[model samples]
Target: MKLRELAHSRTGDKGNTLNVSVICHDARHYEHLRREVTAERVKAFLGDVVRGAVERYELPCIGAFNFVLCEALGGGVTRSLALDAHGKSLSSALMDLDIAAPD
Candidate 1:
């Protein structure tokens, strides 16, 4: 399943860092997300844009995961020439990551 079917996301950025939060629609699905949504997968999904590393923090109580993408903004909005340098749509893009459909 795509992440959007089970979760939703929000994003923020500071300089070259990007933070994307994935929140589960149901608490029961948190475990599945924890298993499936790895830093590796996120890094791979975001691809070349993420120049540094991917770090994932789990929030069990909130049934959410926060992904920190280092050096991902093309050098931040002020420095980045790329359109949408702020990475505002990154959360929406992340929802497209493929995962096993919940049974």
Candidate 2:
């Protein structure tokens, strides 16, 4: 029910920006993910944890949605402790996504 439970995250540093990729499992829930998760929502969820633009990508072959969080590492990896800026954390954020189990 969390991002940690639903998918894995990879963090990268590009200049003063942090690039994070949230790769979801159970590709079948892609539609639910698309409907429930949005850049604005993600920004609200992440809050000060990371800043910048959020982009969503759907990979039909993998049935996974990839979220690219830009400039979220708080001035790059060196300065970030990777804390959840909003208290909900990434896992909690993912849990917030409305996903339906296979019927």
Candidate 3:
């Protein structure tokens, strides 16, 4: 199953960093997502687009996870030549992640 089936995401950017928040549709799925979505997994999935470290912050209270991706924007929005310099599309991309169906 795709992560999109269980959650949605929001994205923000600062300089070369990207922040992606994944929020579960159902709070009960939080633990499952926490187990499956790790900083290393996210970094690997994003590939070279993310040039720096990936950090995951658990938000159990809100059934969400916040991922901070460093050096991902090519540079800041003003400096980056990429069309999606703010990386808004990254949220959609992240939703494509594959995960085992919740038991």
Candidate 4:
């Protein structure tokens, strides 16, 4: 019941902030994600990497959830010495998030 089975994600970054948009394959699953894919949940999932705050914006019209992660890029892509400074793996990693599968 991983979220990936129901949705896909896109990610981008601007300095230390990163944004990940989770788009549901079908609009019907919006409510399910709204309940399970919470900001707190995402923040907890990402853990200490997010130093500031996590905010979620809903796009019901498009059946997508946009998660804005603050201070997540370590020290900005240019400065962070981490091998994956852009945090591209975050999207794939987040796909492992468990969600309730429809019956």
Maximum-lDDT candidate:
3
lDDT by residue (16-67, candidate 1, tens digit) is: 9999999999999999999899999999998998899999999999999999
Question: Candidate 2, which segments miss by more than 4 Å at Cα?
Answer: 1-10, 79-103
Tell me, what's the RMSD of every candidate? Answer: 0.9, 4.4, 0.5, 1.0
Comparing 1 with 4 on lDDT, the higher-scoring candidate is 1
Q: How many backbone clashes does candidate 4 have?
A: 0
lDDT of 1 at 64: 98
Q: List, residue by residue over 1-103, the lDDT tens digit for candidate 4.
A: 9999999999999999999999999989999999999999999988888888999999999999999999998899999987889988888888899888865
Scored against the true structure, residue 78 in model 1 reaches a CA lDDT of 96
lDDT of each: 0.92, 0.57, 0.94, 0.91
- What candidate 3 gets wrong by more than 4 Å, as runs, is none
**Poorest stretch of ten by lDDT in candidate 4:** 94-103
Best by TM-score: 3
Task: For model 1, state the Cα shift of residue 49 in Å.
Answer: 1.1
TM-score of each: 0.95, 0.60, 0.98, 0.95
Q: What is the lDDT of residue 102 in candidate 1?
A: 65
In the range 9-99, model 2's lDDT, one tens digit per residue, is: 5554555554445565766565665566667777777677656787877666765556666766555545656564322245445455543
